[model samples]
Target: MNWRFNICFISFMFLFLLGLSNVFLGIYFCLNNIIYFLEWEIVTLNSMNIIMTLLFDWMSLIFMGFVLFISSMVILYSHNYMEGDVNLVRFILLVLMFVLSMMLLIISPNMISILLGWDGLGLISYLLVIYYQNFKSYSAGMLTVLSNRLGDVAFLLSIAWMLNYGSWNYVFFINFMGNTMESQIIAFLMIFAAMTKSAQIPFSSWLPAAMAAPTPVSALVHSSTLVTAGVYLMIRFNVLIMSTDLSKYLLLVGGMTMFMSGVGANFEYDLKKIIALSTLSQLGLMMSILSMGLPNLAFFHLLTHALFKALLFMCAGVIIHNMLDCQDIRYMGGLVHQLPLTASFFNTSNLALCGFPFLAGFYSKDLILEMCLVSNLNFVSFLFYFVSTGFTACYTARLIYYTMSGDLNMVSCSSVTDESWFMLKGMMGMLFMAVVGGSMLSWVLFPSPLMVCLPFELKTLALSVSVLGAAIGYSMAHTNYNDSLLSMHNILISFFLGSMWFMPYISTRGVYIYPMKIGTNLLKSFDQGWCEGMGGQGMYEALKNFSKTNQSYQNNFLKIYLTFFVLWIILMLLIF
Candidate 1:
């Protein structure tokens, strides 16, 4: 076991080196705005050709570096979190496999190559999601895999659609797709695929369900790798997707997802699920902004969000580890007095997630809000953006208050000590990035200043939302709502909010129950009754009867043959 841990450390170091090389590659590409295209013909059969293509731009290089960096940090974090588990080695390998899948997806330029990575992501994610081998984990893994399979199918269909152009390299077709209906169809399939990966609107149930996995997995898969794959793909396809009707549809779905998840987070009590819901909400914001024709802003937020969200999950892991695996926020309080350092990391990441000024999240989130304000958006879209940002602040403030600020609620407060340095080691690795990632990405990704002139009130809108959300969140958490008249009066309303708008029910029963019932009926009727009775049972009966008749004739064959011979001789003599 000690040697296995060492092997894990070696793997992390190797990944760190890879991350550094990618960073250098990103810097070089950024400096020159160079596009390095690599292609190798793998197969040539008549007119059909299959080639492996890699596209290296600032996007892939920078994103790949971030993915590798975060993965290394997660593996380090898992050392303490997964201690004493016999399967630690396997867990580390799974994390590495997931990282490899993400890398393959990032570097691929051709649709065929992309599917390999995409399916790899889906497969590895399912394995990771069910790593615990519990009923809860199994159910979550099923939902997660089934949801992702839809995207895989969509990608395959898109690949088939792209065959009309005689190439699977989508990079070659971006500029040629504008105003073309065929491209729109392809983009439509691609958008649906992205939506599943990003967990937008109708396909969002699996994101929260995936919290059943280990916390490190939650950090890696939900925050960094799997969820963002869709956004990255959309960023690549922006030329074909932007300003189309499908983009508008994306705008609507993303907005709803963001708002719904935010409102859901406010009522959530499970520490990990709250964070999961927040990830879902932020994903919505990214999708919505991307739909508004700012893929760069979306990509920027994706990178920064990954940093803090991963850090946040690691902090949650520490608390859960010390709390004897209790995830309910109501069971935790005043952890700042007990575990000061972990709480600091936790609070810092939470604030970053809320887009605190000068931190990592602010750089991208502020720009996104400003961009949203200046864009020609409808009233509803504007409301969703501003309100959802406020909701983010509100839920985060509530989380911090419940988990870190209130009275010590644990029965054995002394037992909750942050003595695990390995956990802290991982948190420390990403702390710097969580603080400054947004600023660094903003400067490097957008070297030229964004020119925007806005009214004073418009410029301050995002600030107002943050302040208002914080104030509301604090009041809601601090005040004794049970004693207030509105508490009892709005019981039903509170139940609705707390149930996450019935998404679990709708996604599980509302969507699947009928189809599953129909499937069951079909299996019983067609497979068991008609097919088995007609093809299996009926054929067996006919064969058995034929065999019985042949045996009986053979038994009496001697006597029957003599009678037939005598009759034949008599008939021949009469004819002569």
Candidate 2:
């Protein structure tokens, strides 16, 4: 059997089939009263025990099934995307390892076991982000790893703190005894950890930078698995921390991230970066809703968003591949005529992301909006939610126009054919889900109807934003807004909004400058000067001087030594 047509494709189909079975099983278990719990004792010393506990509920099963489904699709897509790579086998193995880690994370109710999965995700993601072996990949890998390490440290500390409770199993204790101060601290640490993993707010720079990786990896990382892990963690811990100040903080951060990334997408030229930012925005939306005491809704959005977003990235991959590796949307237009199927997928996924009616994003996002309207939220939160919704529509419309609706901009000789059957097959597999995932998840997850009583104004906010955004996006793409660039005032305004309110600076340079200066001082004053002088160089000089003194004394003479010994003996005899 050919290597390209072997383990990778086989694993893809197998996992995909397994995922479908798990989904049915999850629905059955959810409808029934069966909750599967598995555990094994790994180590025990007196009262100190480390046990691996697995919790299989509707949530875990469904989530794991979705993860596997997406992973399998990504692997299938990689068959064509990663062709001719010398390390294709390694890439497939790494992807499988990532899927396994995600499964471990989903099933484990124990913090220690969760760490195994969590660290695996971080490590594998870093490796994947640097798979291209370029300087950009290396930098992105470092940033991604360092950002995720913040979460790792938080998890480790939380585990240490949980040891005081005599067990690492947080699922049980968090439900029963989580009202204590120590538990709150642990909850805070877990929130911090989740934020890093999910690319929330300040820890968000890594998500966009991680687009340096392969597109299949992007589809997997940005859509289904890595980014959603944080949201999943929050959903799991929602009961304990829902009403805490940390949850409120998450609401704030999540909302900000949503708005910032949405705005950033409008300005991004790189096709992949724009899509990546949109993913970030949706993640923010999920995090914000989860922070609002609705983890089920968040999880629902997670699954649905995974479906469409993965499709979106896969569509982007098709375009990029066809365009001879060029990822700039500015250079891409009138592609719909050439690549009809790919364009249809791209447009459908973008519309889904914008929460068009009946699409995968609409069910969850619409409910989230309605829920927010009915909830007792403040003005800022409401504004953030609605405005972010509008921004989402605006940027997605802009994206569609730039990539699918304009005149052809590339060289005339270039030919883009939708001939990659594997790519189309992978995308087609997801197209059905993208169309119906929202409704299916909505029906299954929320068996009872949501009682949302909103006023006319609140009820129509989403529709109004969608229309307005579409209009604005069409106008911007068709017209020439030279005043924004030529005028000093508009230039500053455009710069501010276009640069995502200087988030890149605030997250990178703003964070690095003071620490780097401090590090330089420490290197000069302590590491090289004081610490080295007093530790390594000073000790070496003192030891050398002492050895010289000992050598000189030994060389002085055996005769002198004998005379001193005789004198000492005489003095001893007189004393006696």
Candidate 3:
């Protein structure tokens, strides 16, 4: 790699250490009340609120730690993964840039700082997605960027609303939100932003499109950072949402998204896309729990999802590399003997993801389900959770079976090996953690009394149900049973895809067709007749006609003088 890559990576590592230190110190500052920001300032104070004060809570610390840990792994994984690629150096630089932005995002003190980091992460992610510059990758990157920008606009508008209403800092915003109807509106707007960022129902298409990125990019961005932005935003504003009427709809949206995406995963053939859709579904479940005032559960799931999902994507990448770029799981089969290590890592991660007993996903997912059962939310919410869990099991099982357990018809025995040591080391570390960390963190996050409130007497009961679901799914996969039984209801699928395609139109026009047409015509006339008639057409025509009208004039004294005179007038007005 180039020196620039080395410098950027080293800088990111240094920044990460600084950020971690801030988190630890911030906790101390909060406990001690060392310093605090009462309001906005023209210049930040020295004894200004301790930087730790910004992210002093358990949620922030947990997320920041995950970001730091995953980013470090991605950087190390990239070192070997991108070894001979031409853009290797630029890729590393962009990765560092991405990590730094995420770190800033996790610890940002005010709306402005959070937004700056948010947009920065989005920008670098776009660049990384398009790094290879293939046609499909470029298209995918463009789509992802456009969708993220839509979310950013909502975030910016919410910030504007918060500031206008006299809440300019995190603490103040939370308190103010608790006092007014404006809080409900703000919560809705924030949820809108999160939905788009997290790829919920109507906004989820971009995620599968994003499979065009490199495997590491997919793992780092989709699995860990980009998609999780929405969840982080929700967690950050949990205090507000928990107290508002808007909290009531969270279960509705989150439940529907989880069910819908889980169903959609069954239709996918690409291994990574299947995992991507599942990630969205799982995140939707976490959002549902958060909506029910279970931020702790959401936070826990986010951690586990990051670990196992990253491992799944990385393993998928290794498989694709071995299979000479084939990503269709149908083309893969019976590689367990040849790729024992890969199979072991992949299976372990998949089992964890399916929420097997004692695995990371089991602990996190069970908490969310338990929250749903006991939450004041209606029975429909519980139904959604139950159905979604089964779907999750089916799709996850299909992923494991299709990739690992079938006949050897398409298996290649050319002695293709697992990825490099760095890659394997990262995957193994995650696998080991996924296997053991769930029970440990559960003990820490949920003490005895809370565990007892869960619906099942034995935690093993939930695990048994998840295992049974997986077994049924595996049987279907092995028997080549058609999954059309689990496909989304045709009418609903049609409506959802149709609505996604026309959302921009629907937003500009009303949803009713006649009104929509009238609105469209009005907009067109305003653009072509009113706005263009004023000077737009003239300016456009002038630019187009300039080459023909005055080859010499375009480069001559008269044109130059005219431009200079206009600039001089504008500058004079500004000066005055």
By lDDT, is 1 or 3 better? 1
Tell me, by lDDT, which candidate is best.
Answer: 1
**Cα lDDT, model 3, residue 191:** 90
How well does model 2 score by local distance difference test? 0.86
Per-candidate local distance difference test: 0.88, 0.86, 0.73
Over the stretch 1-576, how does candidate 1's per-residue lDDT look in tens digits? 779789779988998889879977897899798998997888999998677888889889989999999988888888889987898989888888889889989999888888888999999889988988999999889888988899899999999988888888888877787767788889899999999998987888899899988999999986779999999999999878983578899999999998999998888889999999999999999989988888888989999999999999999999999888899998898899999999999999998988899999999898999998778999999999999999999989889888988687777645888899878998998899999888888888888989778899988888889989988987887774324644346888877876777777787787677789989999999998889889988899899999997887788787787887999999999999
TM-score of each: 0.92, 0.91, 0.79
Score candidate 3 by TM-score against the native.
0.79
- Give the Cα-based TM-score of candidate 1 against the true structure: 0.92
Which sections of candidate 2 miss by over 4 Å? 42-50, 480-489, 512-517, 534-536, 539-576
Backbone clashes under 3 angstroms, per model:
0, 0, 1
Rank by lDDT, highest first: 1, 2, 3
TM-score of 2: 0.91
Of candidates 2 and 1, the better by TM-score:
1
Best prediction by TM-score:
1
